[model samples]
Target chain A: MLKKPPSVVLASFRPSTYPRGYASALHSLRPCWMVFLNILILIVVCGVSSAVVLAEDHLAVPANLQVFDTPNDGGQSLTVNWAPGALDSPDVRYQVLVGDAGATDVAALKVVAEFPAHTRLVKDAKGAWWTRTAERNWHQFTIRSGKAVELKDGTVYTVTVAMLKGEERIVGPLLQAAPTPNWFNWNLVNNLVLTLIFGGVVFFSIAHARRRDIFLRRIPGLDAVDEAIGRATELGKPILYLTGAHDMSDPSTIAAAVILGRVAKKTAAYETELLVPHRDPITMAVCQEITKQAYLEAGKPDLFKEDSNFFITSDQFSYTAAVDGIMLRKQPAANFFMGSYFAEALLLTETGASTGAIQIAGTDSDHQLPFFVTTCDYTLIGEELYAASAYLSREPVQLGTLRGQDIGKAMILSVIAIGILLATLGVATQAAWPQYFLDFFKDVK
Target chain B: MDATIIGAWVATGLTLFIFSFLYKDNPLFKLAENLYVGVSVGYTIVKTYDTVIVHLIWKPIVENQEWTLLIPVAIGLLMLTRYVPKAAWLSRYAFAFIVGVGAGLAIPRTVSSFILKQIEDTIRPLLMLVPGEGVTFSWNLMNPASSVNVIIVLIGVSSVLFYFFFSVEHSGPGKMVARTGVMFLMIAFGAAFGYTVMARMSLLIGRLTDLIEYSDPSYGRPTLWLTLVTIGTLIVLSRRSRSEPPDSH
Candidate 1:
């Protein structure tokens, strides 16, 4: 400025005079500074544009968000369902968020469950009409959250689904629902219907049986009971009866007790020694009374020894060991193992088999049935264990129950046949109608 | 000696004593059996006291202020009245309540679990061959499960169910079905027997492993010492019994 320097020099120059090398250094640094500034501006502009693109690229919100109380529950669960949006990809996922219905900020809500994309809906429909009308194409995912997730009965909750694609998220509109307790679940209507039908059949059969005589098929095992007792009487040895390892409360034990009464009466009539050992005290007491009553009925009350039905240790293996010892020592002519058995079944049956005892066993215990079948002279498999009481007692009431059970089984078989036919047709034709038949047996809820 | 080592030794001794019954019933086995019974009974009593008396009865009534719990307590106490000959009849009330409640609870669960579930599982698609893919009719020795297996199951189930139909006489075709049912039953039993044997062998192996662990130096080889002692005792007892006269019943 002092000596009317050039415009370029004036623009680059500071107020103070510089050394000779400084001007050249300043000129070189000026170009570097301009380049750095240009780069910084470019980076800022690109970052802003990228952020806008990211926000715009987010997936569309899921449609038809619905919330409702879970049916057939103890009023502690809520179900969240939503129709999936257009965004379907491997990288996409959905998360269910739950919050108080009155909450102002959706972002503050808690994420209850997260599911991968294309989660299939669980159908809660029954019968042909419902199955036909059900949505087949649209994928609607449902999530059930219970009280364990802080969901309470009677409290309204707002449920929303969020689709997550990469780092971007778009949430659907919230739907409000409250969980209410139901005394009778309509979802279990099929179960109720079946039960009532079976119960009514049983009752009707029992009533009908009282008025007329019914033909009964002979059970081969029942035919051998008297023969086994007679063999024991001839051998001058005691008859061993085990009511199994269960308490009196078990149905098998009740059946055993009933069968034991029949056996006791026969033993009492023949004057054959009877040995009954029990693992439970209650069962022992009940058996003692039953034996006494049997003896009384047989007109040989004095033959019913009080010591016959005695309590052994409640320990499983220990009782088995004791029974095995008795089998080895007493060498009972006939051994009757009735009711339920477990791991000790083989141990007991094997010991009895070795002692040359005529063994007959009946049990509903499928696991131990093989042991009984192999080692014992005869075995009553599964339902035959239940049928033994009626077979031996010949009570009208019991016979009616058995007949009703048979009818129920017949109904089940017919259903199975129909189901199989429908399933085959469905597979061959690729038709949806067969699904209605299959859905009848399905517990949809 | 460490407490844990002593416990291992005791356990090993008891296990060997119990196992000694395989030779013959002896005093040692009887002692072990009685000890087991005593321990189990004691444990049961303690558990009952904790669950029934303390938690269910006392805690709820006192801590939770649930005074209505007395009704159940009174009913439970009545169950003990059976020991008193004069008031024995009173126990029937408790028995009735228990039986009624148990029956009410069991019926629904049994229907759902046993009956309905079994039917649902049985009603499955029988044919698995694809239409356009063409049938590959090769016998897979390793995997017997196929459409044929489904047919076999259906036959087995229906035939067995038919056999149990007491209303139908086993005269004509019924007898044939019943015989087939019997064959199926036998096969099922054979498989179950094989599985049970495997299970029992596994239990034996587990016990043998425990015995081996107790044979370690830290346990002072309790299994070995116990085995020797049990064998010696059994020998002595057998010799004594052989020397004595048989008791007359």
Candidate 2:
């Protein structure tokens, strides 16, 4: 049964003791009470301010919204202008999306215009057949601010704007404006081969899950984890596990935590010391719980040390440095790195190498893989890191998801093959045959 | 050189100095590594104090003027109480709060992102492919090139999603679909793998290219020579490891 949280306001507090004559006790108590009362007063003030801060959020838009006179030297393209949205401030970059009403339903949805808020040009797309007039940065684009759009002068159209900030996608309340669709949009080919390939893998995994015959290529990096832990036990040195700097929200961090569970169990069973240094407080707490559970499962609950998994500063390089310091001082015989890593990957790997520690690393960060592969004894690449957790846990849910992903990969492959064949034939024929392929693959904003 | 220019040169020089480890480690690399460690730790301390203590803790009380800060304060204190082995159970409350909120945020977002959005996007308007004119699979609509591409994309998307679905059994037609999904997945993974391999190899090539370019200068060649010498020394020392007397405890 879950316990209800203690009510913050109603919680009891024990007053500190003051053993003395009544007069003296009263004198000392007066100051304590005064300080407590002052703190209470301060809390009330702070509380209101904090609430205001939370409520102070407003959509950030750019100050300058205007039209650019630059015409497309080639054709009917008109330069649309707008200032950045206030929400992004000076730090965020934006994505520009353009949608047309005559297009498909999804296309009619307000496309991200300038996301970072700095882009100033958009080509006019209205034509006589579509009969839509171009509108500027108005709520409803009808009048093409001094710019003439060649549309049947009487048709109505609507246009809207949306602001994108980082990963936070926010569409501005729809601004209705009329805009004629013009300019040649290249036809884009869907990524058929890639899709087929993903599909195939997922299918086979699921099929095999039933018959229990799926042959997963052995990842040597995974195989080495046990050996690394054992080596540390033999050497009487602690085993250090570094979960990537990202918080628990990142899939990579979750993968790292899952891996930690396995490593913790091994350490518990072997009676070897395990150390996990975390940069995020929440990740640290989760890891501590996982470690404790692993030890408990291994019948070594008494040996689990809460302090073994602790939070370091969240700064990337500092966390790296602190781990390096730990490496130098404790000289852990084995080191495991699993999760997202960045430039500091090299620094940490080199330090481990210098210490002659056996290191195993797994991460999805494409940029950092090279350093890890060269330095670590074994490394899980890209998606394989995610797969490792699913593989180890063998929970039905994880297995099911893995099966799905496999299918996605297989589907991707088939489409690629088909696309290649068609493109080759079109080229051989020297006709408009392959034009369809080229058109379908064209990128739409 | 002006001081600023000299500083730039110094920083660049140090970067190159540390980067030399790809060839072999030396005292220069060690020095740069130590400096990096020191500076990085200093930076982290400032960030942590600012973010966790000042913003999360102090600001609520001193600057933001909030009584509700007491809730977080109490939770934080509860977290610390876990250190006391006797009262460790109390720590679960904080954990529950953090985890519950995190889950609340994650479930909706993940469903929207990975499941709903992706799935919805996959179900494209199939009618768009049908020719408005004559039938017989109008190569106009059925441009073998684009048609094949769309079909492939449809197959990939469908199979991949199908593979992930746990409720249904992948048998008969489902088996075929699932198998196809796996094959497609492998190809995609293979392509991704190939790309990653190329990327990593490129980095290695880049480093080597830089080293080769550096060797063109007289000052740089000596650095290279020094690196080679250090590597040679390390190799000889490593060979003597077995024969060396054991350290006295």
Candidate 3:
């Protein structure tokens, strides 16, 4: 026969119903025994009820767990997602667990991520699913933080999502995923499409440009270049040109080289002395070829000096010091600071300014634009530097590239306009379609 | 007496010598400048040898037994053929490979990071001011500052893009938009200039703080001693230049 606990048995029994001898003995012990028994009963009742309440509070396991390799990545990540259980509460959280594939032991799994409850709602969601859903509830919680960095590529992994309340947890069924290296990232499909479209437009424009004249706007900076060269010629002083601080690989440096060709041709025609100092050896070699070509094109190849384009130290400040020395000593009538520059920009420009040289600078470096604008007589800001090269060269390919860039900008503007209109319509009428229309612009990843 | 103190003194002297160029391009400034250039070139050569020759090429091939790396190693060695008059054309192959690979790699990344990201950022809804909030509009327009900012940004981006459009001539209405674009560009340039000025000033403050620290007695007043020596050297060089005849160009 089973016996109840001492506290429960004591509560059910009474001393009065016992025999006279037993009753007399019990009377003496009744006062103290009843007090001790009452305290023990209270302690046992509280402890048992609290444990039961804690067991009841344990959250239900998350349902419909899914794991897969993250698409359009370098095979370094996996995404785990789960649907919330019916018993999920605000106080409960979900933790994603990862283990080797076919691993059934929950204790062996490692927690990859922990997500607080009620955090599944898309706050700034522009997706069609997010907009169309009337309940405004997330269908599944996506946990991208479950990336297995140490896991080898092509190795399979199992994932589980556990609903947690305090120390108690209930884990969902395991899901398997394998990360494999992808040759091409499909996530950047929009980027690929735009690049192809833009590239096609450029090639078409280039072909068209060869057959006809392309109308290019008057860049004020190009005229200034000619004027500065004329001023240097009239003053019987040399014209100084810098091909910036970058190597030949930089786009800005290439543009600078193109511009240098145009300047060299004019200088050769005028028979004005030209000095070109370079910071990069490769750029120096390329500029030498460009200068020689320009002189040959101008039919003044004999006047081309090999020493005109020479390399200075590649150290930024040292190069700046050398250029500043040239500016002070040579005191060139015209100084051209073209291409990219950093903090040393102001240092060189300030020295050029002190020499009273007619300075013309062109650069896509916005940070250096201010110093050039204040110190130089004429400044080509940002894209104008690239534009000046195309304008000067009148190359069909360069012109075509510029035209393609403009078209790309137009496409972006049209997209923005459509997005704005849709957003306005969505807000005014409280409809889902307009919001869905805006979803195309959102970066899904 | 200590090596660190001597090093600090030397650095302080070199710094002061370089700074003396602000007074005039003297011989001391030239000395310091040349020293900096020589040190920098030497450092670059050592680093390039370690990274390119030792680590990237030799270690991978020798340690990992990656014999396939010899193809790139051969291509790299071909670049040195430029120094040989007869085999100079061989370097063109290396240049072509480098330029081709660089362009192929850069085009996609540049399109994604610069072009697409810029377009994505610009394609935001103009009406939605605060993030994750309903579209806000005010009759006063300026009452909600964020809406006004959004309008300004949209206008700025459109006008600037219009300015760069070459197909259309800027004649009547186009000229007005182009001029507005110029104004925006100028404002951006002005802001950039202000930022550069702040950055330069910060650098100046950093240098000045170092000078002040070096002037402390614990460092044997290296800055003060270096400043005096640089001034004396510059003065002597200026006197010598005055005494000599000017060179004919």
Error of 1 at A352 (Å): 2.6
* Candidate 3 off by > 4 Å: A1-58, A84-90, A120-149, A270-274, A300-307, A429-445, B128-135, B138-145, B240-249
Q: lDDT score, residue A278, model 3? A: 83
Better of 1 and 2 by TM-score: 1
lDDT tens readout by residue for model 2, A1-445: 0121223322424443655554553675675776686668557756766676664454444233332222212232223334434343444544333343354343455333343443332323321112112332221122232223332222333333445555654443333233335343221013233234444665666666766634344556777888999899999999999889677767788889888998999899999999898878778988998999999999999999989998766667656756777787789999988998877787898889899999999997756776787788888876778777766666655675676665554443444455555554654444555544433432222
DockQ of each: 0.32, 0.04, 0.37
For all candidates in order, the CA lDDT equals 0.79, 0.62, 0.78
Q: What fraction of the reference interface contacts is present in each model, in order?
A: 0.37, 0.07, 0.45
Candidate 3 lDDT tens digits, B1-249: 889788778878888888888887777877887788778778777998999899999999999999999999999788778678799779778767765776676677767666656555665444544446555663345643454565777788889888878667898999999899989988998887877778888988988888888898888999988888888887787888899999995
Where does candidate 1 chain A have its weakest 10-residue lDDT segment?
A: A125-134
Instruction: Kindly list the per-residue Cα lDDT of model 3 for residues A1-445, writing each as its tens digit.
Output: 1234454646655545656664554588776877787777767777777776676566766655667776556775676655545556677787877888878898878887676766664333333343222234543433343344366578888878888778877888888888766777655665567678888988887888888878888878878999999999999999999989877677788789889999999999999999998888777877877898899999999999989998777789878888888888888999999999998898999999999999999998877888898889999887788888778888888887777677777877898877777766775667778755555554543
lDDT, candidate 2, at A178: 37
Compute each candidate's TM-score over C-alphas.
0.83, 0.50, 0.83
User: Candidate order by lDDT, highest to lowest?
Assistant: 1, 3, 2
